[model samples]
Every structure is written in C-alpha cells, then in structure tokens.
Target: MATVTYAFLCSGVGLALCERLLSQDTERLRLCLACRNMHRAQAARSALLAAHPTAQVDLLQMDTSSIFSVIRAAQEVRLRYDRLDYLYLNAGIMPNPQFDMKAFFKGLFSSNVITMFATAEGILTQRDGVTPDGLGEIFATNLFGHFLLVRELEPMLCHAGRTSQLIWTSSSNAQRSAFSLEDIQHQTGTQPYSSSKYASDLLSLALNTHYNPQGLYSSVICPGFVMTNLTYSILPSFPAFLWTLLMPLFWLIRMFTNTFTLTPFNGAEALFWLFKQKPESLDPYAKYHSLTSGLGNNYTQPRKMDIDLGTSESLYEKLLQLESEVRRKVEEKKKEAQHAHRHLAGSVSS
Candidate 1:
C-alpha cells in the first residue's frame, strides 16, 4: 500500500486533525505540520509522538505571511516527499480584531440574534496591515500564501495517476459582500478576515475549475465559531475571567445554532469528514461546515456558497498575474542583496 502524506498549514485544529489521522492509521500516514512557529510545531510533534509512539510526524518551518518563507517551505517539501495526499490550508489571522459591543448588545434583542452570535456577522471587524511583501497581511496569510504553496507543489498534488485534496479552513463569517474583485487584498476593509475567507471560497472554486482535470481537487470548510487563539484575540481588552464568564452565554447561544463549534476538536469535524471522502464525491460549490449541537454532538453539513464561475475565474487570472509580479520583485531583491554582498567583500579584500 502506498503511504499517505498530509500537510497542515497551522496548529490549533490542524493539530487536532493530525491526532485524528494518526490515531486511525499511524503506520500508513506521514503528517507534516507546516507552521510559522518552530517552537510550537516541535511541541505539537512531541505530543503527537508521545501519544502514538510509532507515528511519523515531521515539522516544516513556514511563515505563511512571508513570501520567501512559503517558497522555501515548498522547496523543502518537494525535496522530502514524492507525493502529497492532503494539504490543509488552515493558517489565518484576524489581527487586532474590534468587536462592536453596542451592536452585539443590540443584536441580542433582534430576530437575527442567532445569526449574529453564530457568525459574529455584524459585530466583528479587524484592523489589517501590509506584509513586507506589500501584500495585505490577512490576504497573504489566509489565501494567497496557500495558493502559492499549491502552485509550488503542483508536481506532487497534480500527479497524473493519483489525486490530491486541498482542504481550506474557511468560516461562516465569509460574507460575499466583504470581498471585492478590484481590491482582492481588502486594503480598505475593516473586515479583512471575512474578505480573506471569502477570497478563499472563490479560489477553491477556481481551483476545482482549473485543476480538477489535473487530479488536484479543492474544497472549503467552515469550522464554525471555534474558540481558538484567533477568537481570544477578538477582544484583547477583556480579561481572561470575562471570557470565562461568557462561556455560559455562548453555550446558551449554541442551543439555537450549531455553528458554535467551540473546541478545536469539534471545529475539525468537517475537515476530518472530508478525509474519508473521495475528492470527486464532494460538492465544489458547497462550503462544508463543522457544527455542534447544544448537547455537544458534532456533525458536518454543506451549504451552497454565494459565488459565481465568472468571478472565480476572474480572481484566478488576477492571482496568476500577481504571482508573476511577486516573483519578479523577489528575484530583483535577491539580485540586489547579492550585489551588495559582493561589493562589501571586494572592499574588505582591498
């Protein structure tokens, strides 16, 4: 039997998925945690190995926000693996999130309270900025970095006889209105997190349209309202005790809507479900959601996303053009650094 390889782009629920995968098929599967933090990655590897002694879990240092880091990580993967069975594009950020407490309080009395709580739709916004690459940090980390990684690993993912899966950790908050075709980076938006996720939804459809023939399949999933580090960052001003106090309220809200998949394990249900499925069996137009009942039972459901083929194709083309421009800039920076190094060396020798 051929060994299956899985690469996850973040920790949190990605680590949970790793545990699920290894518990069932430790001997036959190789798991790689591609994370920006080597320390956390090493610790996660240790914990997984401690639980499943013989499982193969490797670590790749990758900062998805940095173009050079993503490129280097992809190169490393190419050298280490001949085939990749699954790639979880789960790394994301909602830096400096601003929660509208007034809106939150007002929404509690409204008919759409369930929707507001489940998706944080009207009550959440974020402060976003640019990366060193001049790409919006949220856009770079959440979507384009994963896109570039897929492009770099096309050899393994698009192997002729075999198939590969790309599972994106999208969200219930990914509103169609948040994203703009002209400003793909969400430069002027307060909801960069939502915009980035919406972009991922569009990109997944485009990937299916473009690479399904090449044996590469892409699907997007929402982890519901998971209480990971990202969620904690939403209210940085709040004390730890305040969140603890709000847990009961959250539980009550979960009664009405199953989108409050609060734990990483629960959030990973949809992702883990997809692992058992044949990529060809999935609905490319549907966004699979990980849901949990008030009683805490977990399940997966698919909802059709508000997207169009025309828009998806247009985004794909724009990404291709941006990729070309980014590569040129990276090459020019490399050459300039080399030239400066050579000049310094010559002067020192003289």
Candidate 2:
C-alpha cells in the first residue's frame, strides 16, 4: 500500500477539521501539520500523539501570510517527502472584522432572514491590510500563499502515475460581485475575505483545467458557519461567556438553516468526506458543503459553483503574473540586503 501523506496548512489546536480527520484513521495517515507558530504546532502534534501513540505526525513551520515563510516551508516539505497525496489549504484569516448589528437585527425581521443568516451577507465587513509581501493580508493568507506553495510543490504533487488532491476551505460568503480580476488582491475592499474565497473557488476550477492532465486534482469546500476563532473574531466585543449563553439561540437558527454547522467537527464533515472520494469522479464545478440537520446530524453535499471556465482561466493567469512579480521582488530584496551587508563589512575592514 502506498503511504498516503497529508499536509495541512494552518491547522493547529482547536481546529476541528484536523482533529476529526485524524480521529477517523490515525494509523493510516502520515500527517504533517504546517503552521506559522512552532510552539502551537508542537502542541498540536503532542495532542494528536496522545490520542494515537503510533500515528505518524510531523510539523512544518509556515506562515501563509508571508511569501518568504511559504517559500522556505515549501523547500522544507520537498526535502522531507517524496510524494504528497493530499494538501489541505486550510489556513485563512478575516482581520479586523466588524459586525453590523443594525443590519443583523433588520434582517431578522425581513423575508431574507434565512439567506442573511446562511451567507452573513450585508451583515459583516472587515478591515484588510497589506502583508510584507505587498499583497492583501486576506488574499495572501486565504489564497495566494497556498497558490504559491502548490506551485512550489508541483513536482511532488504531479507524478507520472499517481494523483494528488488539493482541497481548499472555501466559504458560502464568497460573492461573485465581490471579486474583480483587476483587483485580484481586494486591496480596496472591506469584503476581502469574501473576495479571497471567491477567487479560491475560481482558482480551483482553473487548477483542474490546467493540472488534471498532469495527475493533479483541485476541489473547494465550504465548512459552513462554524464558531471557531475566526468566527469569534467577527464580534470581538461579544464575550466568550455571552457566546456560550447564545448557544441556544444559535441552535434555534440552525433549525431554520442547515448551514449553521456551529461546531468545528461538524464543519469539517465535507473535508473528511472528500478524503474518501475518487478525484476523477468528483465534480470540478461543485463546492462541497458541510451541512447539519435540525437533529444535529452532519453530512456533506455538493452545490454547483457560480464560476465559469473563462473567469477561472482569467484569474489563473492573473495569479501567475502576480506570482512572478512577487518572486522577483523577494529576490531583489535579498540582493539589496546582501549588498548592504557587504558595504558595511568593507567599511569596518577599512
């Protein structure tokens, strides 16, 4: 049997999907936790090992928000593994989120209440910043960094006879109108999170178009509205105690819409489900969603995405261009630092 290697980006402690995925078949998986913080990654590894003493779990230091970090991490991964079977692009961020209480209250009384709750449309906005890579933080963390990593690992992912899977954690909040090919980074938008996710959905389709022949497959999944750290950050003013108190109300909302998969384990259903599927048999145009019924049963379902081949291909080209530019900038910065260091050394010697 081929040793199935699974590398998860940004999945640490409290990440329900990582825990659930490991619980299913710890003995079968060769799991690698790719995270920005080594301390947290160590903790996550220890926890997993505690649960399954014989499970193979490793760690890689990677910060998806930083291009330099991603590049270095990808190099390390290439050194460690001969072939990668599954790459989970699960690292994401929604910075400086602001919730619109007025809109939420008004929508509660409107006919579109269910829609509002399901998608959180018009109910949330976020302040985005540029990363050191000169890319939008949301765009870098949610999509571009993962894109770069995939490109770097193409050699391992695309082999002669074996197939590799790229699964992205996308969201229902991904809106068609929010993303623009010209502003692929969403630099000027308050909905950077939404725009970034929409771009991922588009990029996944494009990846399938370009890499499928090379034995690499790409797919997107929505984990629904799970009350993870990302979700809690939306309403930072709401104390953890208050959120705990509101659990009953959230459950009531869950009854109205199955998208209210309030827990991380439930939110990870689609990701775990996709692990069992044949990549060729899956629909490239569909977004797999983790849903929960009123009785709290978890299941995965596929919903047709709003993306088309033309837009996907267009976005893919734009990303490749950006990738080239970013790499050039990184190289130039390295050269400048080297020149400065040499100048200082010469002056000191004189």
Candidate 3:
C-alpha cells in the first residue's frame, strides 16, 4: 500500500504491525519479510491477507548463520526495492538454552527480578563446533549474518532521496560485564548468547557511526522478555500437559512483568517504537531497554542502559574488515561459478 519498504526480519511479531498498518487510511507501505523458514512465513502471509487482502507483501529465505544466505537475501532485496524505509532486525536465538531453576525460584521470591540470570533471557549455547558459514555459531547467526546483510544491501539503504533506518532487536538482560573484546566469540567460557546480543548493541552503535554520515541510521532495542519458541527451550522438560497447568499463573505474571511465558508480544515494544522513530534521533550508545509492567495494562517504555562506547567503536572497525573480506570471498566465488558454467557450455557446444 505505502511505498515505504519495511523489511520485518523474522517478523515473529509482525501480526500486530500488519493489523495496525492495514487499519491505516493510506496504502503507502509494502512489506518484505525475511524469515529462516518458508512455512511460517506463508502462514503469516495467509493471516495478513485475511485482514488486508490487497497488502503487497513477499517473503525471502534467510538463515543468519550462513554468509551465503545473507548475501543471497540481500540480492533478492536489491532486486525488488530501490529504497528501503525501515529494517527491523528482530530475529534472534538462544540455541540449546537451559535455565538454572535455582536462580529462577530465588528470583520468584524477590521483587519481579525482571532480568534475573535464569529466565527466558538465558545466554546462548550452540551445537559444538558447527556453523552454516564456518564461523562461531552464535557470532555467525546472531551478529555476522545481519552484519553481512546490511553491508550487501548498502546501495538499497543509501538511496539519495529516501530515509532509511536499521533496528537491532536487543534484550534488557544484557550486562556490560558479560561482554569481552578478547573473547568476542564467547568461546572462552562466557555466555555466547549474551556476548552476541552485546555485539548487536555494538554493531547498531557502530552502524550509526559509519553510515549515518551517508544518510543511514541505526538503533538497538531490548524486548523485555517474551515467550516464544526461543523461550520454550528453557522451560523445564516437564510434561507438556502438566506445564499447561501453569497458564493461570503465567497470565497473572504477564500482568506484572509480561515475561511470565504467556507469549512474547510485549517484547516487540521497543521494536514497534523504533519503527515509528527517526534513527538519528536515538542514542546509538544506549541499550534501548523495553520495560513492560503489564499490570492489567501493557506498559512498554524505553530507558537507556550502561554501554562501552570504546568497545562499540572497536567492534565496528573489526566488522568493517570482516565485511570487506566477505565481499572479496563472494566476488571470488562468483567468478569461479561463472567460469565453471562457461566451461560446461563450451563442452556442450563442441
């Protein structure tokens, strides 16, 4: 409807946006959703059409763990849109997630310790020594994959007459102490998930530094806590039927902190705000924390948190280098693929 190109990455919470946008009087926005799986994307599409039958929306396959996938995804985006209005990088994971029940029970007795260590906000653990692109699993999927997408799509981003923004889906549980430059990959006994989110924070900050001058802006937001596939990973392996027993309490807590495992809808608050705000108008160095005290009402607010600007800047430089190297590799591979095709064609002609 609107010419605004909104790429809702992972769009797990896109239903709300679709409803709100479709209700608007103007048909001035078109959507491109980047998702890891096709089925989920199609289901989302079906739901959207049920409400807004004429919505111009398409889906593209993207697995952030794969550099090649990011490249291909960007290529697809470039093919469709000459200018991008907003990019909400809402896709994230806590692979192999495990909760420390001791910590959870302890927090339960205290004031809604919203960011307690053992909640759905648990750090990441990947399958040992595996990545779609052969990089650190967490780093590759959670950070580098999005990083490469922005790089490859820079042209669509920096179009002369349009406003563009980049959004990073961050979390309130992020701690400065959890991240270390020496162990950026989190391979040295640190929580890989935390380090990766920290990297997302840094990358968003870095993006403002590098590209804002060229008319692009980036900001990061933390969705307080949400109950999604990513959260169920930490729900103790109790019988599913038995856990359904907690539904009443879950809804009660969702009233207090909104992290009680009903659903992750509140987590999209920061994301929703950034969607409507100017990127340069936000603090790149801040962790835009989302707070939801759902006390019979959903209250979503953003407050700045402590961050290291020095580390954020340094990480930016490293990412630039990585982006450059990846581009080189992609170029080399393109040449090889082209050459192989030409040789095969020559043999057939002979």
| Reference-based lDDT, residue 12, model 2 | 25
User: Least lDDT summed over 10 consecutive residues: which range in candidate 1?
Assistant: 2-11
lDDT of 2 by residue, 1-350 (tens): 66778998755213566677777886668888898889988988887788778788889999998999999999999998888999999899998998999999999899998788778899999899988777889999999999999999999999878789999999999999999988998887789999999999999999999999999999999988888888788888888899999789889988888999888778888988998999989999999999999999999999999999999999999999999999999999999999999999999999
Residue-pair clashes per candidate: 0, 0, 8
**Which stretches in model 1 have alpha-carbon errors above 4 Å?**
none
Candidate 1's TM-score reads 0.98
Candidates in descending lDDT order: 1, 2, 3
1-350 per-residue lDDT for model 3 (tens digits) = 34777887755555555555555622787878788888988988788778888887788899988888888888888888878878877777666655566766877677645445323343333342457445777777778888888888888788665568988877654556667777776777446777788788877877877788778888877665555666556554756776578566566665656443234455565666666676667777666644555554444455665666678888888877877887788789899999999999999999
User: Can you write out model 1's per-residue Cα lDDT over 259-294, one digit (the tens) per residue?
Assistant: 999899999999999999999999999999999998
User: Which is superior by TM-score, 1 or 2?
Assistant: 1
Best by lDDT: 1
**lDDT head-to-head 1 vs 3, winner:** 1
Q: Cα lDDT for residue 264, model 2?
A: 79
Clashing pairs in 1: none
CA shift of 88, model 2, Å:
0.4
CA lDDT of each prediction against the hidden true structure: 0.92, 0.89, 0.70
Q: What's the TM for model 3?
A: 0.86
